[model samples]
Target: MNRREFLKKTAVSAAATSLLAWPNEVWAGGTVNLTILHTNDMHSRIDPFPNDGRTNGGLGGMARRATLINQIRQQEKNVLLLDSGDIFQGTPYFNFFGGELEYKLMTQMRYDATTFGNHDFDNGLAGLQRQLPNAGFSFLSANYDFSNTILKNQFQPYQVFEKEGIKIGVFGLGIELAGLVDKKNYGATVYLDPGQRAADMVKQLREKENCNLVICLSHLGYKYENAKIDDRKLAQQVPGIDLILGGHTHTFMEAPEKINRTNGHETLINQVGWAGINLGRMDFTFSKKSKQKINVAAAVLPIGKTVISS
Candidate 1:
């Protein structure tokens, strides 16, 4: 969908009321609302795009995004700021600073967690490890085994977050790096099968951890015409993931698409465009009576001067 249509369908003023059709009784019976804000492939576009007559001109700036996030935080009680990956490469900021600025800025934003994109390996494992101290949040990667590399024990396979007595399980998955990345850059970072890893993660998160909501921070592309294991395929193959926030292909989805799983469950997949043009938001309400059951609403907030004024 185009930007105009997307904004029309998911207007910022109407997002909270229109996304989900749950009744008032759900909120009256001790329902907890969790707001998830996500971004992906923000390849060092710290400043707003130049107003050079391009389609993306005058859109996307970290400061503007921060303003929007702060606005939301003031209004919402439980909020999670996350990224899907590819936090490096694209602009001269990465070339000069080597991801230090990116990490520092995301730290300032209080990002809860993030996954790895193939470009994250551009500077090799050591470069990534060197800048880890600047980040205060966690890095989650379920499929990439970092045992043999310098990143061993640096990332968790999955993390469980408890907010207002609700357990939210979050995990990360990266695309295969061997073919997409330089061998020297991603040396010894063994890539595992994402489908098997996702199944294992879901089982552990649901059965053992007893998580109320399961989310996957996936760097897998949204969908591929070929037989690649993209987010759509992963959602179809795995039954328990409630949501997949995706990246890598830089797809600008008009809205989250629902994929039916084999076990009669539905997984929602969402991806904003690259370069921090949009911030993806998903609100989930869980009742005390049924913590495992949830009602979700999604919106894509465009970051710009107009948005700040609105």
Candidate 2:
């Protein structure tokens, strides 16, 4: 289907149910289910937007997000919370705390992993390093080479998580920072070719590691008219990537775009808007015997008063 049609179909599907329902047939035959909850470009929104009658007024807040995540964790057995990037900057909270509070709160909410956005370098490498201790999760970025800076050996190219006999391999990709971010802020950090890095990660994660699912947390936006290698391009160039949770464009996609890869496999790319206004969720049911994905469901849930009070 075309992008517009795909989006329309999925948006309608999501509107019908807050959480997509998994068909019973897909759950039969010893299938394992996993729920992935994700956010991107949160930009240090500690509290909900002021009730100023604007479009996004009273929409997002870290507290509301935490409560929603906790509720999902209680319902799902295998849950992974991930962020695509830009965990820092935007609001006064980031300006005052320099991302320390953001890291701490994400730690409390038990974020599994995150990638780096260009704005994440606003405080420079040293500042980011100082706040690293507050985060309980790993920073995964396969494309950015930090060996020459203080961030050397600080981030992982990818991470593997196993739950209920299912192995999940997750890696990260970042946007090129030269033009987007100041050179002084990202000094000595070399940006690698994201397509090549992703190919390498897929080989290791799928062939070497034998992961049942492969996910890429990408900060490469969704798509670009120019040749900037956005998430859509990455999906087309790389094979074996099952899902891509993306950011950097703050594009509010109601549903994920399913791209058919060259190798006959498919990839799902989803990115919620910025400022923690929405949470992107994807549910997958896999066959335990064949180690293949059987079914999938998704939703872009808005963070509003329906959730517990912040």
Candidate 3:
């Protein structure tokens, strides 16, 4: 069976149902730290897995995820929650509701933004578009040209946000979904060359928009052995993209990979494992003392088989 099929057969568990200490200094302190929380290849597994003898038996569920997100947002002065994609198709939740539950839960969790994955088109363009309005966060896909379709103006090429004196630019890049998805499902959504589009968008975000941190929310997976384009290639070829949050490969990276781009700019790539069993967190610390990016502490936190609330 294909990877998606394997996950579909084994990953489904439950529906959406229902963390931590803040340093006192955070509410009234200097050295503002930005916490970036992310997920990918969620695949609509809305509940923590039951005791199934698997390594991650009891982890992941939208309700547990929301509890964690709310806890962090309440403490951090600046927090950005994002997802890379594959937000549809896995459990009967998606099969029955047609992605409504996933989008609604994501909306409740306040996802800042997300891209597209091939599986997102399982219900076809009309089905996906029908549920679009329910999403609180904007959908961005720089390389997917939706012109001549209903999604043209509804989606953005990139989004810029200024948080705590920091400028962040986020955009999306989709994998080539032709061979991966049914032609009838994706319809006339023209897929552009990701490398070319990445270069162009990075230039615009860094030079024109003056965004200090440029991030690419990618559903392009990570490195592949062959010539197939992936996130690693995009990072090496595109300059000025500070980070690439990736999906589509279900790559559970130990930590974010630091790579030097064509212009010698540093880019960090990270992806949590599939099924929401892990939550990827990257802490960006900008030193006002030196006026530079001082450090990045990255971790993949496990939700691990049980629901915990703070």
Worst 10 residues of 1 by lDDT: 10-19
Any idea what lDDT model 2 has? 0.87
Q: Give the lDDT of residue 35 in candidate 3.
A: 76
- Put down candidate 2 lDDT per residue, 124-238, tens digits, no spaces: 9999998999999989999999999999999999999998889999999999999899999999999999999999999999999999899999999998999889999999989
Cα lDDT tens digits for candidate 3, 183-268: 99988899999999998898899889988788999999898999999989888877788889999999988778888755657888
| Candidate 1 residue-wise lDDT, 1-310, digit = tens | 3323433544553243234455667656787778899999999899999989998899998988988888778767889998999999999999999999999999999999999999999899998998899988999999999999988888999999988889999999999997789999989999999999999999999999999889999999999999999999999989999999999999998778889765788888999989999998887878865664556767778887335322
Alpha-carbon RMSD of each model? 3.8, 5.2, 8.7
| Candidate that beats the other on lDDT, 1 or 3, i.e. the better one | 1
Task: Give the candidates in order of lDDT, highest first.
Answer: 1, 2, 3
Best-fitting candidate, scored by TM-score:
1
Candidate 1: C-alpha RMSD after superposition:
3.8
lDDT of model 3 at position 246 = 98
Q: Global lDDT for candidate 3?
A: 0.81
Q: What ranges in model 2 sit over 4 Å off?
A: 1-28, 305-310
- How do these models rank on TM-score, best leading? 1, 2, 3
